[model samples]
Target: MSSTRSDVSVLIPFSKRNKDQEEALRQCPSVQMSDLIFSDIEEKETLLDYVQRVKKLVTEENINIILPTCDLSTMVHAAIARDFPHIPGPTVESCYLAFHKAYSRQYLDPAADLVPYAVVDLDSPTMLQDAERALEKVGFPAFVKPAAAQSTFGVAKVKNYQDMNRALQNLRTMRDEHPGFKSSPSAPFFKDYFKQYLDVEKYPLALRDVVIVEPYMDAEALYTVDGCVVDNEIVRWAITDEHRFDHGDAKFGQDLIAPTSNVRRLTEAALGCL
Candidate 1:
């Protein structure tokens, strides 16, 4: 807010093995960014540790905002926002709400004109059957993604039984390997002898407990409305053209113009209806 603090510091997870990290480093302004990564050589620098470290750095550096763009970072960002008041961020809870398809849908009227969704319980023995039911309810070639996911990392559009089965299996496997999936103390994976060989769950139960089956919307032209909430009001808003060409030719068309006043109003109303 001041001339001395005019520069905004953005903290993002970085890794040498990641091409995105390399690209980000190359493109980012030298004085306006900080990268944090966990390494075996860095004491107490686990993924969770990296999150806390970044938050601390944000405070010390007087960062204006924190934007978490990935699943891991978003989870950490939400946790810090929900638990710690010291962390500097805008509407972490709102972002957290957006992270889950099920919760996001809760705030909306079910009968509203929007995409359809079905909830598949994770602990059910007839899990596949439930998924199939959801498919039947939503119609074929439906979008399937972890209800708690951010990106289209595990998303798929299945048209038939075989593809559906394969997708279900893949999602189940993903849940198994999730770092946040907790094993029972009595479970074999938790036993002292086998613990070392176990893989941590990648996401927490809040994310992995349910699956969202939806009729994918046509977003050939997509745009993201970025805003900052201050004093419980949307103080500053900007429109960015969403572009994602890598994740299965899913390009966010920048040619699509930002929503005009009437369109913006409709979009906000639609978002409210989830």
Candidate 2:
């Protein structure tokens, strides 16, 4: 969890979240990492049980103001914020929408001009039919991944049926290496909280460990808007505009200051350092 310590941003890395990816992540020039305790829900442990378990540590260690830093931690952030109302964070429904691509596509609907896509359950009896329908709607050279993923850990670009199978194999392999992903059996609390807002009978695929098949977005430039919220006000920070791979790695990733469109500078904002 990322927090603010006396106005200096501090990040506490949890072992369960990073696990096998820890070393690869530390190689990034910008990350500030520390050796922290591992956090996870044991078998038969309820969400409240897990939350209370972590809460004890939080209070004992004087942890305050935990904000999520990525897609995987959004639900965890919501749970923590729910326990401590004084600590601000996104709501369970909002976090669910952001964390799951299939639901996000459903929620966005006709409002957004998104490409056609399908949500396929890999373990479902109708898995083949689902994939067929997905590819039919979305078309070739599609991008695929587990409905929920952190970073691009399980994502792949596929051009045909064989490629899709290969992508799922890679995804399953990653899940084995890195546990706690929503793609697998999620924590009880994470699923329980979602039940409040979603109708399981109507959208069974919403919370299931499914795969989302959609057309690959090959953009010349990809951008990310990073910011913080305080008292309902959004404090816009740096806007990172990154180019595609150079030697299999991002060629040029630069941050533009303050706002969208009318970016006046080339350097990163203070938050970028965090």
Candidate 3:
């Protein structure tokens, strides 16, 4: 298909409402645009519910493409993309491997120097015990984060056993408070979704329940690339270097600048591995 706006029906999923996206679509003039409510797995609405709702909207509205602006929405759209071929994003398998930290670690199998980490499954009855073991292996000055979460929701830096325990306790409290869908099978819409991508017996813990313990890196800069794969070819779009505000214990992105060729190539090499 041509890259013309007239030939595409784009659907963007937002956590609440986004006036920016609406304004961007208005400027386009020829594109068909719609919104899909973005639901967190920890929220009252389940992932299945969100996907089913989106699938129905796509069918009724004839949405030809999904532009997932959030991590949760990316996974949701990727899961259902098989039914709707025009969604421009990663495949279901790739999304599962990439979005889930633990699974991605296993799939990528990065060099020891690149990533030294261990996965802890919170769904297990012995999660605390497993975490303790992981702590011992990863040692002090490490990070504990949910395997499939985004926006640094369940991320913490721990320096000692006491800190690790406190972090784990906080994560457990969050999980207890947010208990996701009681049963996936009970939701008829999830039948096909599960059959296509899920194997509960194999991966006992859901993606969200998995956690990773990894050594902390005191990095001075962060870089990212925005790209896509079309016709089995990787296309580079843009690269930017992220500047962050460091506040003793935490860091947040403050600005982004287009990097030079050398930095862009380095970032491209990293993306190639993925």
Candidate 4:
């Protein structure tokens, strides 16, 4: 039987100022209003520390469940769930694979995939050779981005070598500024990466060790699933279409609909595969 009095913790990675977040919190009957707003800056250790603190709080405050309410929070929660069997949610490795564009595509498991992609090490000179091959494979009008990034922050749509060079230069600068970009566990292996493709002195590459090159997807429509899981089984769920502003930031759509038949089938398959 469910406990009469319950304590729940909801972690939102970005910020509480987001309107969709505010609305989501407003609607949650189980979550306390005060237990909100956890932020993660560029610091990696902060995340490790935050999870440890949350684990302690769960015991002291009796946090029955931890809800990952945003893109970043999902990662944080997933990691915590790995070590603490009591912390219920997606595992860190699962969330990491899904969040990464390069890895996410692998899970799609399509014979002739909608998106064409390649993974590279932006720090290696051989990356140019690798990129040339990838370009030939994906063709022109490709999208280049950090392997593990969110939104359209470092994303570039390039049509030629000249455009690709300029875009790569800009991405290298962003990489220097964001440490998490370079420090991923998978960064060291890519033979051709940021080094071959960028000017490190000017860009001052920070550490985005891996990069993903892909054909630009014609994403006219996008959707997301917000769900809760107990024992790796999804329970409560809300499916929402992603509506973007001029800046391309996504939130709860004004028009809400259940997942598309295709998306539902695909998501179920993906989950089962997980």
lDDT of each: 0.50, 0.57, 0.60, 0.54
Query: Candidate 3: lDDT of 125?
Result: 84
lDDT by residue for model 4 (1-274), tens = 2222234444444344566545644443433344544444444444444555666655565544455545556665665566567656675556655656665776686876476678766777887777777788888878777776554456667778776677666666665665444223223322122243224454332234566787765566767666655455664455666543333322213344665433333222222212
- What are the per-residue Cα lDDT tens digits for candidate 3 across 1-274? 2233444555666455566644544444334334333223434555666677878877877776666644556667686577677654566667656666777777674555455789876657887788889988888789887776655556778888787778777776766665553321112223344555677455544433567899877787767665556557765756767655565675544465765444333222222222
Taking the tens digit of each residue's C-alpha lDDT, what string does model 1 give over 56-170? 7656665433444343455455544544564554344565456556768876877898777787766679888998899889887677766654435566777776777787777
Clashing pairs in 1: 178-201, 178-202, 179-200, 179-201, 179-202, 180-201
Whole-model lDDT, model 3: 0.60
For model 3, give the 10-residue run with minimal summed lDDT. Answer: 181-190
Candidates ranked, most accurate by lDDT first = 3, 2, 4, 1
Position 179, candidate 1: lDDT = 39
Shift of residue 126 alpha carbon in model 4, Å: 1.4
Per-residue lDDT over 1-274 for candidate 2, one digit per residue giving the tens place of the 0 to 100 score: 2442233222232325654443443333443434334465565554445565777766665554453444545566677777777555677667777667788888885877677888887667877677878898999878786676544446677778887777666665655554445444342324565565455666576556678888876667777776655446665655666623442322323233333632211111212323
Model 4, residue 24: what's the lDDT?
49
Which candidate leads the pack in TM-score?
A: 3
Q: Compared to the true structure, candidate 3 yields what TM-score?
A: 0.73
Per-model RMSD to reference = 9.9, 8.4, 6.7, 8.9
